[model samples]
Target: MKFNKKIFNLSAWITLLIAYVLPYQSQSSDGHSTYLGYPLSFLTINNTPIYKTLFMTESIDIFTLTIDILIVYFVMHFANVYLSKVKLNKGMNKTKDFK
Candidate 1:
């Protein structure tokens, strides 16, 4: 099997989103405590993170992040597919004007 640009770009995008999406420290309590009472599991299925912040197990984060990530992948692919085809239409119109 081979890895490709799509894999890296999507992974990088999610990684950045998580790193930045973490609720701001200003919103958190005093920067010393996690909003949640426990370390969060990145894979938390529900609103558990609404309470803790110790950092959940990587296993959990992985499982939870997967579904969201696959959705992102499909969305990007769909958008690009339409955009690419649209560009061809644009060129056809431009050529028609010249003729």
Candidate 2:
């Protein structure tokens, strides 16, 4: 549960993969607004969804990809920290009981 280098690296790799897989398309079809390449047709505001699924489009939007990567990175980092803290607390409790 600790935030070791291995775990951090693994998460980093996963984040990179996600960013690469979810490409952002800039232009919207038929004057429809798009976030990355997905049409915002579903939303009333005519804005594309922030998250796009794989196999939706071939092109990649660099800007949106970067944003996704950063968001994932931060979330993973925070998760690691939280898990480590919980683990440390559990260990401390176990030692105290033994003593």
Candidate 3:
């Protein structure tokens, strides 16, 4: 199979969008919080001991975001490759039947 740049780019963007919309969220009663997203977090709510009952804070975790992006990208790539192979096989089978 040949590598397609368009497919690669499309998968990258799709994975990013998915990561952006769906992030890993966590909340703890101990005043610790986490909201990790791909590339950047849209919103984060952190609770400190003092502000735990009052309000929350916001921040980004680059390490987790990078890992999340990588994971989603690989999964998307695998699905894309698998689907393309299935499609190619179907086409080949159709041609064989015609012959």
**CA error at residue 44 for candidate 3, angstroms:** 4.4
Q: Quantify all predictions' global Cα lDDT against the true fold.
A: 0.49, 0.52, 0.62
**Per model, how many backbone clashes are there?**
11, 3, 0
Q: Estimate each model's TM-score.
A: 0.51, 0.49, 0.59
Q: Where is model 2 more than 4 Å wrong at Cα?
A: 1-57
Q: TM-score of model 3 relative to the true fold? A: 0.59
**TM-score of predicted structure 2:** 0.49
Which portions of model 1 miss their true places by more than 4 Å? 1-4, 15-59
| Candidate 1: worst-modelled 10 consecutive residues by lDDT | 36-45
User: What is the Å distance of residue 26 in model 2 from its true position?
Assistant: 14
Ranking by TM-score: 3, 1, 2
Q: What is candidate 2's CA lDDT for residue 65?
A: 47
Cα displacement (angstroms), candidate 2, residue 55, comes to 13
